[model samples]
Structure formats: structure tokens, C-alpha cells
Target: MSTATSSSDLIGLVLGTLRTERASTARFTLSAPWSLRSDGVEGLLIRVSLGEPYWIEADGAEPVLIQPGDIVLLPQGAPHIVRSARELAPLPFSGLLAQHMSGAHGDHPITFRHGGEGGHGAALTELFSLHLWMPQHRGQSLLSWLPPLIVLRAAEVATTRTLALATQALVDETLTQVPGWQLVTARMADLLLVHVLRAHLQSGAAQAQGWLAGIGDKAIGKALAQMHANPELPWSVASLSRVSHQSRSVFSERFVQRMGTTPMRYLADVRMGIASQQFEQGQADVARVAQDVGYASEKAFSRAFERWAGQTPSQYLKLRTNGAQIRRHKG
Candidate 1:
């Protein structure tokens, strides 16, 4: 909710929000002192700052030059840093000061702050982080809308302090461990995400068709929201047409043209995404998940999931479990 959430914190929060969990702002950290590091989780990141500059490092792509109000998204999760632009690495993501940079770097964390040069100056270096553990379900259905990177300038968002404050509160309560902060943080983070995304859609960037972009459009976005909000609705052309206030033929055409797929196909994709999420969340019974996603039987769902996910539900869950274990082991 608060711009106080750093790139990692925002990702974590968004992840947590989608997971329907108590965690708000997801699993990450905020910095009191300045910082430069790779994200623990590979996802979206949002960073905003003034005065002291920062640098982000990712493989292949050139180093991103960051300034205050420069909202940057390192979508690929390439290792990077946020520091003075003057002292940048001309080659790739390597920075000079990284030579001496040392601390208890064990895991990735989200961050937010106000600061002077050198470090977060006088104000206790006020910083915040949101640690969100995304459930498998949250990743696919709702996550499809996100881009690799998104930067919303403070100048553009400054007018909406209420939303900003709400987000800040989400980060603060989550980071500071205030009473009832987790519950409150989740709600505020959701609202704040809606507002920030709305602002991005209005910007008219080419990549705006991303997650937030759809939300800003009246028809397409609304339709998408409906499908995502209820992926297992057993929706058909008639139902979708009725909901969107168009005739069957017209609705069918528009949905295909706009979403680039037929309503049924779109529904199938949504189901697959939800199915993948279930796998990550640790639901092993394929039949139950299939029914939950509107499939009448396991055979039909298996056919669909195999096509959409390239693996059966059972295989996919096994892969995810193995992957999570490997991550933990590597950690």
C-alpha cells in the first residue's frame, strides 16, 4: 500500500494477497541503510527513491540507471543493486562499491525508506518490508497480468496519498510487528495494488496490456476480473455474454478478439493456472482439484491440464515439490 514497499516487498505483498494468506506484502525486506542485492524470489520488483541513486544488475540486459521517481521493474530477477548512478558499472551489472559491500546476506528481503546520502540519514532510516509466501493457486490465475518490470513515478502517484498511506501502513505493520498488522496489511496491500495498477494503465505505455492494463479497461478488464475471480464458474458463452451485457454472438467475438482466445479456451487456460496454483499449495488429489476447477471428471481435466501445463496435475505437483525442496536445499 505504501510506496514504502521496495521492489521485493511489493512482489511479496502481491504474492501474499493473491494466495489468500495472512502474509501481506509477501516475503521480502525493507532497508534502513542503503542496499544492493539480488532478489531471493524471482518475480516482479518495484523501487522508488530520491537523492541517493541506485543501480540494478541483470544478465544480458544493460544496467538500469535509477533515479528518484524512476519506478523500475527488473522482471527477470537478475541480480542488481540500488546505489549512486555516478558510480555505475559500464559493463553488465557489476558495480564498484560491491567490492566492499558486505553484511548478513542470507536471503532476499523487501524494503522501503527515506534517506540522505551515505545511508538513510536522520529519520531512523525508516524502512519497511513485506514477506509474502505465494500459494500455488495465486501464481497463475491472477499472476498472468504482471509484467517483468513496472515503474510508477511518485509524481504520478503523489496525488493519491490515501492509497499510498494505506500501502505504507501495510508495510509498516507487517515489518514492525504491530498488533493485528498482518490482517490489516493484507487488505491494505490489495487496495493499494489496485490503485497503483490503475495509475499504470492510465499511463498508456505499450506494455500497459500487462496485468494492470486490463484492470483499467472497462469491458475487457471487467471480463477478465470475472473469469479470474471465479475461474471454476463453468462459464459458457451464454453466461459470459449475459454478464457482459452482450448477445452470445457478439460476446463470443469480442472475447476472442480482445483476449486472443475463445471464451472456452480462455476458461481452460484459467483452469490450468488455478490448477498449477493448487499444486504449489500442496494439493495432491488431482480429482478434487479438477472438480474444484469446474471439470466434471479427472479424464477431462487431465486432458486439459496436460495440454495447458505440459504435464499431468500429479506430475506438475511433484515437479513443484521437488523444485521447492531444491530451493530450500540450495538455500
Candidate 2:
């Protein structure tokens, strides 16, 4: 396969697994001198700018100015501050919600207004906040590889305009609260996420390091595509290098440089990741899974899984099963 097609296929496979379990959307209207702080969250936090410009300060990162039409993603759930100015003292986001919202449940979006009255020509800011909860086992690895803060500028998003349209649709559906708006908004959010990630990946910002960078590299991407496409294959450095059309030494070095792991280690991770997904999806036969992931014996597969996951296969299954039971019980 061509390099571009290979990379796209790998990306599609990985992204397809990021299914959100629950999602909530809200609109925030604030006047000048207002700030809100999030002490991080369990899943992803997305903020879309709709009105005046604002500032975002994520922990361990420099403050970023967000203009209207821009989107900011906290993929790693880092503690962050959103404010009219960088130095504003932020009210805790939880406290703000408690003070302004009550029994906020259901599919419709909630709108809350805060801060000083619109006097003295204070700037008013409008923002759409999206919180998505994804399965931890499926999302944790991908989220860990992404930067804590990702800002997709409006100028860049204008090239495709799909993201812009999706955001607009989300805002409209939520505000109108028409019948079936809930489903419409949810689907729109999913589309918005895919577009945001595609834009980020294509912007070269994600090329700095990690698995994302590896997928963006022409040579490395080919090898990664092969591995993801057929994890059951007994792939060696030489085989993968040939698939990538590079010398084994060069391929190995570049893989480590971009992915921070050797080829075999990355393959192991890919296999384990696939195995975890299968287990989550109700595959319980240990030996079958072992062979499916290329291991010759259940004992060898169990050993490798334990080393990678810090738990035996049965133990992992037990945890997942218990967790599902708890969720069902709560429901």
C-alpha cells in the first residue's frame, strides 16, 4: 500500500475504537473579569470559542489565546484555567456549576451565565463545553500519547469548514431543544472530534513525537500499518523493515526515536492493545486469544500479557467483568 493510504488506515483503526460512552454539552456566557478552573477531569474536555477572545492556561504549558471560531482540546484532562485574561483569579468550575445549575441531567445542553453584569463595556464571552467519557481501557493509551493541550485555530479549520459546520449544528441543536436534538447533537460531537483530530494530525503539530509522529512518518507509517493490519503475523525487525522499505538498522533507530520503543516492543504493545479490546468485547478464551495475537502457547501469551498489563489474563477479565457488573447495577 502507498504510504499515505497505509498511515490513514492505521489512524482510522485506532480512532474507530474511541467511542464515547457518555457525553454532555453546555454553553457558558460570561462577562469580563471572569475565570473558571478545572482541576482536570476523567475523560476529555473540549471548548469551542463562539464570542470574544479568551485565554487558556493548562498546567505545565504556557497560556494560549483563543479567538472566536477556535477550538481547544484537553485530551489528557490536565488542570486548566479559562478566563478573559491570564491573571484573573478563577472560580472552581465545580463550584460554578453547583451555584448556577441544578439537577443538570439528560441530553439537552445547559446554558449558564456568570460573572459581573454586562456594565462598563465589559467583554462578554460565549463558549461551548463538551465533556466526553470514553472507555478507559480503549482510550487511555491513545490519550496518553497526545499532548495535554491541542488548539485548532479558526484559520486552519476554515480550509475544510466541516468542523465549523459541526460546531454550529451542535450549538443550534442544543439551543433549539427540538425533538431528537439529543441524538443529532451527539452524532455531531463525534464528527467534530474526528475532524479536530484529523486537522491536528495534518497540521504537523503532532509530529513532534509519540505514536502519532510515527504514523505520520512515511517509512515508519508503512510498518505500523502492517502491524496493525495483521497483529497475528509473526513480524520481525527485518520483515517490518522490508515492509517499510528501509534498512533494518535505520528502521529500528527511527522507530525508537519517534515512538520511544523498539520495534518488537511496539509490536508487543499493539498485540496487547488488541488483546485488551477483544477481552473487553467478551472474548474469554485465553488460548484462542494467545494464538490470535501470534503467541504459540497460552503460557507464553499469559507471561507476556502479565508483563505488559501488570495482571494475568484471568485477573484482567475479572476486573473488567466486575466493572461491567457495577455499571449495569448502577444503571
Candidate 3:
């Protein structure tokens, strides 16, 4: 499926390639002098602080203070600790998960209280968080461009009203639990995430050499979106440069500088990434996968796939299947 992308498009290609899956939602009510250390799961985490400000310290990163109405996206699932203050020692989140599992009777938000028992606490910090999962390949393309923590501050709400409104709607739906709320909140969560990402991209904060930078660039972003929109198309430097409204030489130089690779090489990587996703699904044969990804011949596709994946197509399939089987047996 090909899409004509423009320089003004935000996250069109990233959203097109990704499949978002909802996981769980929980509201944490904690008294002052509390902290929880959560190990990163294989997914994304969206946190919104409602009642009080808190400190979040992720591994290999500095601590950030989260204020009310602030939306934070842990795109890469980096392990982190959330505390009411900077000096508190954190308790493992597994303990809270275990408690919730033991007491869970329905599909309701998991609730936890810290620093005090029962319901009487003078100062309480309330935080609501939702978990989501995205396909690994596309997730990497998105997350690699993000910092370990992304905060959409409450101050930006005036100019970015849609974001503020989305956050409010998600919180309301999650809290009120109206009919069809599961589906409603799932979509709202998806929209909220997209807006958060778009805001980050437009903020000019992502300076690293990756797809994020490409998306922020005026000329290169359009070409990047087109390549991602149809990785299977036989794309050439000249064709992509035209889409970017630049000559071949200038576009090639800009793309290489921003993305750290030539346009053709980047297209090759996108094709391989799509092929890997298909292989993981196990729904297509080698020949069809090869052709669908723009290779005219299976041998040529196999050679390229191996160079990108360090394994032949068959080997890659077998390994993926074996990994699934092992996981099932373990379960």
C-alpha cells in the first residue's frame, strides 16, 4: 500500500507501520513518602499524574518531576522508579501486581495504596497509568528517537489543547467506566499517544540521528514517510528526491546527514524490517514474502535478508517458530 506523504505529515509513516495493542490500566493512590520501582516490560507505558507531583527516575537517566496533568510516555519501556520524593526507597512493583492478581475479581483498574493502611491518609498522590504494546520493529523505529522519558507539560496545554483534552477524556473514561469503555478508552489511549509523539516531533527536541530526526526535517521527512509508506515499491534516490522537492545531490547529502545512511540503504533496511515482521507472523511463504517486499527473485531476497538479519530466511523462520514454541512450553 503506497501513500503520498508530505513534509507537514506527522507520524504518518510510523503510525501506518505500527499495530497498537492495549494491555492494562491501573490507578495508583499513594501517600507521601512512597516509591515504586517497576521493571520495564516488553511494551509502552503512559503515565498521567492527577493529584500531586512526583519524582520519576529511570535507569541511566536523571530524575524528572511529574506535575498534575502531565503526560509521560515511556516509549522503550525503560525500568524506572516513581517516588513521592527524591529520597524515598522504592518497593518492587511485582508486589503490587501480585496483590492485585490475588484480589482481582473483574476487569477493573488495579488500585494500590502506599505508606499507609486502609483509607485514611492526610496527603495522597494519585496517578493513573495505562500500558500498551507495539510491534517490536516499528516500536524500535519510534522509540529510538525518543528520550527515556517524554513529558508533555501542563503548560503546553493552552497551545496544544487537543492533547490536554485527550488526556482529560482518557482519564474520565477510565475513571467513569461507562458502557463500552474498554474499547472507548483503548482508542483514546491510542490517540493520546499519537498526539504526544507528534508534539515531541514538532518540539525540535529530538536531535539524534534517527527516524525521529528525519520526521522533523522539512525535506527528508517527506521522503522518509514515502519510503515507510511503501517499502515494497522500487524506490530510487532520484524518485525520493523529487518527492522531497530537491535535486538528487542535495537530497542525498541531507538524508545521509540526518539519517546516517544513504537513501537507498535506508530503503533496503525498511524492506528488511517489513520482511522480518511478516516472518514473525508466520502467515506467508518465503516466495510470497520476498516478492511482496519488492525483490524480484527469492535468491536475491534471501541474500539481502541474510545480510540484514545475519540469518537466511528459512533459518530466521525456524528460529522464530522455535522461540514461540519454547515460550508456550514454558507457559
Candidate 4:
């Protein structure tokens, strides 16, 4: 396969693993002199500006101006402030929700209207917010490799007309609340995420370093695809280099340079990631999961899992089980 196609396929595989579970969607309409602070959140947070321009300041980052048609993603759900001006005193986001939301759960998007009366020449802003829960095992790695704030500018959205159309559709679906609107909005939000990542990759931001840079590299991407596609395989530097059509030494050096880890180490991490997912999903048979991930014996797998995850298999399972029970109790 051509290098571009290989890279694209590798990206597809990586993105495919990032499945999102819908949590909540909110539509906010604010007049000028309004600001809200989110004290970090779990899972991914997405915000799309549909009306007047606004400013967002993520923790430890400079403020960013978000214009109409602009999409902002907090992949790690960092604490942030959205305001009409950077100097404005921000109110807690939870306060707004408590004041406006009626505590009714349904398919309809939660609506919040805050700010001064609209009589004066106040700037009115409308934005849609979405929260999604990503897979526990894979999401942390993927999100860690990404910048905290990913902004797809309005100009870029205009150029990629599909993104603009999808955003509009999401907004309309959330507002109208037609039959099956929940599912439609969720799917659209997911699609927008894909487009945003693609745009970010194409913008050369992925060329610097990290997993994205590894996927963008022609030779390294091929090896990564092979590993991800079959983590159970007994992969080595020599074998992976052969697949990449490069000498063993050259491929190994390039992979390490791009991915910041040795080829074998990356493969081990991939295997462990799959095994962790299995465990998180209630797989009680440790031996089965070990064998499935190419561990010759349960003891060896346990040692490696402990090294990679900082916890033994049983300990990890017990922790996960306890966490689930607590969530159930709260529910």
C-alpha cells in the first residue's frame, strides 16, 4: 500500500478504538457580561459556538477567541472559563445548571439562559455543549498524547463544509428534539470529533511528536498498524521492520524517534492495553485474557500487567469492581 493510504488506515484503526458514550448535551444562551467556570470534568467535553464570539481560557493556557462556527474540544476535560471578556468575574458552571435546569431527565437537551436583560446593546451568545465518556483503557493514552485544547477555527470549518453542516445538524437536532434526536445528536457529535482530529493531523500539528507523529510517519505507521491489528502476535523489531520494508536498525531508530518508545515496548503496551480493557469489562478469567494477549502463562502476564499498570490483575479487578459498586449505589 502507498504510504498515505497506510497512514490513513493506521489513523482509522486508532480512531476506531476511541468510542464515546454520550453523557449529556446542553445549549447555552448568554448575554454580554456573562462568564462561567467549569472546575474540570470527567470524560471529554465539546463546545461549539453558534452566535457571537466568546473567549475561553483553559487552565494554564492563554485565552482563545471562539467565533461562530468554531468548535472547541477539551479532550482531557481540563478546568476552563468561558466568558465575554477575560477580565470578567466567572460564576461556577454548576450554579448556572442549578438555577436553570429543572432536574428533569429526558431526550431534550438541557437549556440554560443567563446574563443581563437584553434591552441594552449587549452581545448575545449561543453555544452547544456535549459531554461524552470515552473508553477507560484507551482513552487515557490517546488523550494524553493530545494537546489539552484543540480548536478548529471558523475558517477551517468553513473550508471543510461538512463540519459546518454537521454542527448545524447537531444544533438543530438538539433544539428540535424530534424522535431519535438523542441518537442523532450523539452520532453527529462523534463525527465532528473525527473531522476535528483529521483537520488537526492535516494541519501538521501531528508532525512534531507523540503517537500522532508516529502515525503520520510513513515507515513507523505501518509497523504500528500491524501491532494494533494483532497485538497477540509475537512481534519483534526484525519482524516489524520487515513489514515496514526498512532495515531493522533504521526502522527501530525511526519508531523510537517518532513514538518516544522502542518498538517492542510499544507492542507490549498495546497488548497490555487490550488486556486491561478485557479486565475492565468484567473478564474474570485471567488466564484466558493472558493467553488471548500472547502471554505464554498467567504468571508472566501477571508480572507484565503489574509492571505496566502498577497493579496486579486481581488488585486491578477488585478496584474496578469496587468502583462499579459505588457507582451503582449512588445511582
Candidate 5:
């Protein structure tokens, strides 16, 4: 996180960090099928089958047939479409009445279609999008080891029955649009995500590598946890080497190969990422955050912040809080 020149790299790092934090200030909602086309998706798409089976088509990858209890991951974020059991008809974003937005804006909208005989049946379709602000990882890493797409299916377990029923209640709550029901929707989205993540972990796939792989490794997991727990420790490669019981050079190489980042860069990122979280939560004072991140002077912190965040600390905070507010309003 010491330096990131690309937005995609920053997004990959931010997505990695947010995938685990329980505070989960992020949100999820049931978008009208084309609503995803209007809303910014740039991330992941999750859909629950309503009745009929559907499939996906993408380049440099095989078209996946999705069934009940199966989840698919489109790793490369290619153009994807979900069609009925009978045909491979495409559902492009243009069909949703949105213009040039396809290429003029940021990430194209990722669409999640709830298709099945159920037809939004008793359960409302849910789409969760998580975006976090953090500096990007710098180096070759495991982020590329994962498949281009991933899916988790839950139809087989008896526990899923309860999930379906609860989702039905969510459907009712959203349709009625009761006071504070958005909170209910947000909560349900969080819960549903936990359920989906659980299935992914249970599958023991390589893609679960980000969180599970990092946290599960005896050496690297311990190191990542330590970095996260005490980001302001002014950590150095030798310090981490002592903790991981490896030589300094060995530790640096292993961390880079395993985590896709150098130790100092990761430490800088964790500290600044923590600061970013505080800013998002409305902790407005940049000077105080600079202290918390262990910068003795505001000037150094500001330079680092501008380099990592592409804005001054104050500007970054304002953008986060105000930008988040704007998104909430648009929703």
C-alpha cells in the first residue's frame, strides 16, 4: 500500500480487506433485474434461482450451467448474461435503456437475474455490492491464482430452507417499504452474504484463498493477523521475520510470493486502510488520524495519504464521507 498507481490495484486490495471485516458498513439490496444495469456494479453478482435453471457465457472461459444450490463466480468480470433453461439469449445492459454508460463510466453494471419457475417466487432476489477504500497491493500475487468466475450453491442443505423463508420475509419487508425497512434489507443482505461465504469456505476451493488462505496459513495467516492487529507498530521486514521465525530476506520473499506484497507496503496499507475506515465512519480530523497511523508529523502523513489515496488526507476524508452520502442518496 506504500504506492499504487492504478485504480484496479487499489480496488483489489480494498475488496480483499473488506471481505473480512465484520462491521460491514457495506450494503446489499434486491435490484430490479435491470436495476443492476442502472446501478454501478463493478464488483460481484450473486443471484438465487427463482424457478428455471440458467447459465452464463464469457470469453476465455466456459459457459457455466447454474442450477439450484450452485453459485458461479465470474472472475474476469466479463460480459455475462443469465438465460432461461431453453435458450442462450443475451440480456445486454442496453436493453435496460441506459446509454453510453457502458463504456463512458467506471465498471460496467454487473447484473444478477433471479430466474426460475419461482419468478421472484416467495423469495426476493438479492444483490450485494461491497466497495472499500484502501491503497493497492504492489507486486505479483495470488489475486491472479483464482478462477475467472466463482459460484456457491445452497439448495441442498436443510438450513437453506430457513434462509429461503427468511428471504421470503425480506421480500415482504422490501415490497411494503416500511419505515426503517432498508435497515432490514441491509441486514438480510449481510446475513445472506455470510451464508454464501460459508458455502464457499466449505467448498475448500482455491478462490477462498484471499481470506481463508491468508487467515488459514500457519505462517502467513499469523503474519497477516499481526499486521492487521497492530498496523502502527512501525513494522519492518526484520521485525516480521522474527515473528514468522524466518530470516529477513526469506521472510520478505515469502511474503511477496504468498501475499502479493512487500512487508513494508502491506504495513503501510494496513495502517492507511485503518485510517480510511475511520474516515469513512466520519472521523474528520486528518491530524488525529495521522497520529493514529503513527506518523509523527502531519506533512509526512499528508504526502503518504496523497500518494496512496490520490488526494490529501482532508480531501480524502471529505470525498469518502460525501461520496458515500451521495451514493446513499442515489440509492
Candidate 6:
């Protein structure tokens, strides 16, 4: 395969493991003197404003003014309050949902009306929200690489026509509940997220050395592609440097500068991450996962896995199975 394709495939492989589930979309119609606060949420909460500006006060941060055509991503699901004015008394999001939403938007979004006593007030804010849940195993690491809050302004979105279109489509989709609208909106949401990430990477903000920065660097990007393309290969720094056509010192320095980790450490993380997923999914036994990830000795693999995962392979697998059972029972 071509080098570019391999790098893209590696990125896709990493992101594909993050499956979005239980996505619930909601639109809010709000008037002045209105506010809504959600307690700490466990999953992601994305909000886009399509109308008048509002104030969003997230925990541990100053209140942000979100203007029309602005999108906000709260990846950690931090508790936040959205208000027409900063001093408004906040209403609980749950209570607002109970009061206004009838839960009738099957496969679509539910509309919530806030701060209108008996539906008599003039509404001024139009906000759309999407609550997304990522897979447990890989999702944690994925989130660690991202900031707690990401806001894309109208001007930024305007830079990428595709992103603008996708964002606009989401706003349109929220307003009109047509047939198969859920699927279309979901696809658009995914597209918006991908484009946003790409735009962020292209910008210099994420250049502080991480996977995001590494992916944008040509030499490190090629080396990463090689490592991910064949995790089972017995890869050394020299070999990876050769892939990037750099000397050992040059490659190692550049890799660390871009990825914030050594080539060997990056390879180990990739292998272990893949192995954990395989084990969690019951796709492979302990020995198989170890071997597939390039570990020759099961004992050595178990030791390394323990150091990385905080438990031995067997223990981790058993705990995962029990957790799944508990979740199933709760469901």
C-alpha cells in the first residue's frame, strides 16, 4: 500500500475503535432570564448554537460566550450551565427535559422549551445538543489526547467548506424531522467531528508533542504508520528511523519532539492497546493477544501488560467480564 494510505489507515484504525453509542440529540428553545445546568455527565456533550449568543459556564473555566454558528465540544462531560445572561437562575436540564420533552422523537431529536411559563414567553435562543458515549476500553486513552473543551467559531468553520456544510446540515436537520433524518444527522455529526479534528491538527495549536502533533509531521507520521501497520513486527528504533530515512539520533529526537514519547514506547503502547481491545472483545485468548502484539514469552507479556494495565492479563480479563455482566444486569 502507498505510504499516505497506510498513515490514513492507521488513523482510521485508532479512531474506528471509538464507537459512538446511545446518541441522544436535543434542541432547546429558550427565552431571556433562562439557564440550564447539567450535573457532571459521564459522556460527551456537544452543543451548537444556531441563533442568538449565550453564556456557557463550565466547571474550572470562565464563562464563554457562544455566538451564532459556534460549536462546542465538552469531551469530559464537565458540569456546565448555559444561560441567556450570566446571572440568570439556572434550571436543571433533567427537569427541563421532563417538562418539555415528550420522548416522542424516535430516532431523532427532542425539543425542549425553557423559561417560558405556560409557553407564553418569547424565545431567543436556539441550541442543539448531542450526547455521545464512546467505547470504554479505548475511549479513555483517546480522550486523554484531547482538550476538555473545544470550540469552533463560525469563522473557523468557514475556512473548511465541508465542515461548514456539515455543521449547517446538522442545524437544518435539527429543525426539520424528516424520515431517515436520524441516520443522516448522525453521519453529519461524525463528519463534522472528523473535519474539526483535521482542522485542529492542521493548525499549530496541537504542536506540543502528542499523537495529534505526530500525525501532522511527515517523518514521524511515516514512522507511526509503519509501527501501526505491523505491530507484530520486531521493530527497533533503527528500523523505524530507516523507514523515515533518518539516522538513529535524528529520528529519535524528531520522534520525541513530535510524539512526546520514544519510538519503542509508542510501539509498546500501540501493541498493548490493540491487545487489550482484543482481549476485551473476547476475540483472542491471552496467549494469542500476546503473540499477535509481538510478545514471544507469555510470562513477559503478562508482566508488561500488568505494568501498563494495572493487572495481569487473566485478572484483567476476568474483571472486564464481570464488569460487562454488571452492566448487562443493570441494563
Of the two candidates 1 and 2, the one with more favorable TM-score, higher being better, is 2
Query: Every model's Cα RMSD, please?
Result: 8.3, 3.5, 4.6, 3.9, 8.4, 4.9
| Per-prediction tally of clashes | 33, 0, 0, 0, 21, 0
Per-residue CA lDDT of candidate 1, range 1-331, in tens? Answer: 1212233333333344354333434222223344444433433333333343355544434556544444444333335544334353333212422332232221222333222333434323222333333333323444455554555666566745444444544554554555666556545544445455556656665253443443444554545656666666777778777766778897777666555457777667667767776777788999999988888889999998888766777787788888778656864
lDDT per residue, candidate 5, 1-331, as tens digits?
3321222223334343434211111112322332222222343333444433455554435656666435444432335554443243444554442442233222233232332334434334343232211222231122233454666655554466466546544544444445555455445554555555445545565343354444444565556656665566667778778777778888777777766557777677667667766776678887888888878888998898777767787787676677667655755
What is the lDDT of every predicted structure here?
0.51, 0.77, 0.73, 0.75, 0.50, 0.70
Give the alpha carbon lDDT tens digit for every residue of 1-331 in model 6. 3356444455665554444544657777787768889885666776776656899888857888988767787866778888988888887887656656544322446776666563445548877777665444433355455666667776665655445445555656765766655556556556556655665665555647677778877788888887776788888999889888899999999988877678897787777777777876776477888889889988889998877777788888888788768655753
TM-score for predicted model 5 compared with the true structure: 0.66
For all predicted structures, in order, the TM-scores are 0.59, 0.83, 0.77, 0.80, 0.66, 0.72
Q: 21-67, model 2: which lDDT tens digit per residue? A: 55667788889879989888877877776668999989857989998
- Give the runs in model 1 whose Cα sits over 4 Å from its true position: 1-41, 53-71, 74-89, 94-147, 159-192, 202-213, 323-331
Where model 5 places Cα greater than 4 Å from the true spot, the runs are 1-40, 57-60, 71-79, 85-89, 97-148, 155-172, 191-195, 208-211, 324-331
Which scores better on TM-score, 2 or 5?
2
Q: Write the per-residue lDDT of candidate 4 for residues 44-128, one digit (tens) a residue.
A: 7778766688999997689999888777889888899999888899999977676666443323467877887866677898877
Residue-level lDDT for 106 in candidate 6:
29
What is residue 322's positional error in candidate 1, in angstroms? 3.6
Give the least accurate 10-residue stretch of model 3, judged by summed lDDT: 101-110
Candidates ranked, most accurate by TM-score first? 2, 4, 3, 6, 5, 1
lDDT tens readout by residue for model 3, 1-331 = 4345653454755654454534556677787778889888667788876667899988758899988878888878789999988888889998887787533322555666776543654567777777765555433344545677888777765544446446555655665566665556567667776777777766776667877788878789878887877777788999999888999999999998888778988788778777877887775498999888889999999999888777898988898889768645753
How should the candidates be ordered by lDDT, best one leading?
2, 4, 3, 6, 1, 5
